[model samples]
Target: MTQAAAYSAARRKLHWGWITPPVLFAAIIAGATIGETRIPVATVLQVLGNNLLGTDYAVGRIDAGIVWDYRVSRAVVAACCGAGLALSGVVLQALLRNALADPYLLGISAGASTGAVAVTVAGVGAGVISLSVGAFAGATLSFLLVAALARAAGGGMGVRGAGVIVLAGIAGSQLFNALTAFVIAKSANAEQARGIMFWLMGNLSGVRWDDVWLAVPAAALGLGACLWHVRSLDAFTFGAGSAASLGVPVRRVQIVLIGLAALVTAAMVSMVGSIGFVGLVVPHAMRFVVGVRHARLVPASALAGAVFLIVSDILSRVLVPGQVLPIGVITALVGAPAFALILVRGRAR
Candidate 1:
């Protein structure tokens, strides 16, 4: 390719890379904020402008009640949670050097669930912060154990060496799940048991603004780390041998990136109870749209992930006559088919 043409093409990709995320983020935020008393587009904008200006005046006020309670909080939680999980997935895919790698493919979700269940069942823990802390701890510890075992099993340190750890995570996750069930069942407080159940199903019913801060730093950190390492991630695409020959420090980068992804996953799962597929499905889909460059892919995945979850949460909130389906259900619905397609396509290739 000619230098000028290549330069122009690269510039175009860069521009779209930045533009797509905020656009997708904005649309999802607006759509999810629209519920029964659907706010007109113009009104939503006015409220947005007023808030950005730190004013009491809103752009448009529809039904004051819906705006105050259900829609706004739900939209915020969905955006944060979606971005967190999606970014985690992108980093993880690079770490594993596997197109199929997902955020929860490690035992993080299971361990996080165990920690969250303990908090809900025990009833003496600090609300969301305590739960987030416990979950992150559990997730990190589980991955550490699995990765350590994989290193030993592989006779070296690298993604291949860590492959066995994936299996270990699966086993560990099953044990954690069983333990979570037992812990909740034995809580012995009826209200605590009910809370535990609701948490397990995953709902945004009571999501407060406060619960969001826990995820923000983790998501930003993980995505930032991945973006910084985009070249290294791309090098690994050709396989570990190629990456190492290219000075990728394949093992060290793998460890750091995977760790970051795990932290992001732990943070989100703790708050939202394991929303699925944004990580697995969104990144792969974005790959088709934007190509395999991690720089573009990471942000695109973040944006797509946000849009996917916000819409899914909207569906979960409004799907039934009088009840909301857990957000996890909608994600699972979208993710399962997409995941199956990825697997099938991989086989075809």
Candidate 2:
């Protein structure tokens, strides 16, 4: 094909890429309508429209409350968490140039969990900092530690350095996980320990609209920040030396992108504990659908991740009927096999 025609065809494909987001939105709506009470789709729509658009449409007060107050908020939180985590994965994979890189893989989740556990179990920062703030601080500290260790091991900018970073991350994760466990074991009452355990396992139940406000904005901002660095990410895929030669300010961009990824991971984990697999698997899945270009991959991954988690959250609710499973459990069950398949395929290749 001629260059212009090929460009046109690619643009057309990109336009078709728009379909995923709408489908995800539809899935979110469908998920919101499902629960123990089983709100109808039409009632859910009416409630959402009346609240969001100031429409005159009416629904049963209980149904409206369930849809508008409970289910919608939970779904939004799930979507935001999923999108943020997946976007974090995309950025980290590009920054580290490692297909296996994920938000949790780098100790961010462990750090967040540690910080949260410290607050909940030990009350270390109870008066001074909230759990969410503590989690963010811990996540930031973990990323800094990993970066510093990787740099010390041998500058964290190339393939060798990526390996060092991964090793450092594993060490950091283990350390934080140990700290979290110690805090829970030593200080927490049985009830507190159970709550901590449940949070660690990743429950989205009882999330309020307040959480929606915190999570959605953070996720949106993080995604915007990552998208802003798309050119830099693209440049880095060729190596730090190549990116620098292309005027990408390789180290600065890497730090900024990684920090953004950490921020997204911290935000989500703070609200809902460390849910796994969305970050690890969603990016790869979206890459298969949208190709490897960061511009397409980032947004597509965000939408797909949102959809994946929303559906997973619904399954978590309905799986046992009247009892909710931890959303993280569901994701791990799905993601582990998906990851294994990816590994097997890679080996075959």
Candidate 3:
């Protein structure tokens, strides 16, 4: 290639890299400002400035509270959840060497749901542990169980291992989902069951700052861990033997990255229920733009996922005026079709 042409390509790549972060930030701000009450973008910024920068601003108390306390928090949580789930999806797909692997597909979300339902509906460990804690515990346990089953089934870093893991995940998801149903059916009254069902469908309606605090750091840690092992992930693409020969400590890296993915999935699922598609679709969609390298794919998928979910959350709120639709329903409506398309495109390739 000519030097000028190469330079232009480099410039384009640099431009995209620089522009994505700001664009995602703008999307989050837009999401925060464009909710039911319709806070202006400027007002949202001013409210955030007042709190974060100690800047004097004259936004109304209600508007300020709505922006700072509720809308912004919800937007942040949505971004965190989206990024975390997308990162998890990328890691799982890379680690397992499978395009179809995702946190939900691996039963983590169902496990977290079972845990949350046990606390919220069945009143198990309610006083001793919060709902989020219970959900994380459930998710961790589910992941452990799946890991054990997969290992026992001779699952490792290849197609055979990927198949075993998928099968185990399907089994685990079904088992936990049934347990969740049973808990709700036996323990919850009619009204409580209705509310539990809505939560299970993934409502982010009443998100507060606490939710944001919980989700954001967990996502950050998970993403950081994934990025730290990007080189190993790339090596694993060839095969476990190749990766091991390259000094990647293949088994340890797999366990750590998968664990991180599961942890992030649990954190998000505990807060938002099992909102699907962000993890599965975002990584696949970003791959077309950022290429297959985990180093680029991880961050690109994270940002794209955040933008997608924030937009989805906005649509969920505005689609029915005052009524809020469960975010999971919107994701499923979008993800199922996108997943089909990915499969078709994969087949074509």
Q: Where in model 2 is the C-alpha error above 4 Å? A: 1-21, 155-159
lDDT for model 3: 0.86
lDDT of 2 by residue, 154-256 (tens): 8555667778878988988888889999999999889988887888978899688999989989888977887788778888788778888999887788777
Off by over 4 Å in 1: 1-13, 54-65, 123-129, 149-163
Q: Is candidate 1 or candidate 3 better by lDDT?
A: 3
Question: What is the clash count for each candidate, in the order shown?
Answer: 2, 0, 0
Model 1 lDDT tens row, 1-349 = 5999679758866886678767865765575355544666655554655556666653334443455445665677777778778887777776666565675666677777887667756554656557777787777876776666666677243556456756766677777778888887777477777766666666777776676676567767876787788889888777778899998898898888877777777778777786667787888888878888877787778777877888887787677756778888888888899879877886797
Q: Which 10 consecutive residues of model 2 have the lowest summed lDDT?
A: 12-21
- Provide the clash count, candidate 1: 2
Overlapping backbone residue pairs in candidate 3 total 0
Candidate 1 positional error at 15, Å: 2.1
Q: TM-scores, in order shown?
A: 0.85, 0.92, 0.91
Q: Which residue pairs come into collision in candidate 2?
A: none
lDDT tens digits, residue span 73-189, model 3? 888899999999999999888877887789888888999999988987778984888887888888888888888999998887667878899999999989999999999999999
**lDDT against the true structure, each candidate:** 0.72, 0.84, 0.86
Ranking by lDDT: 3, 2, 1
Residue 25 accuracy (lDDT) in model 1: 54
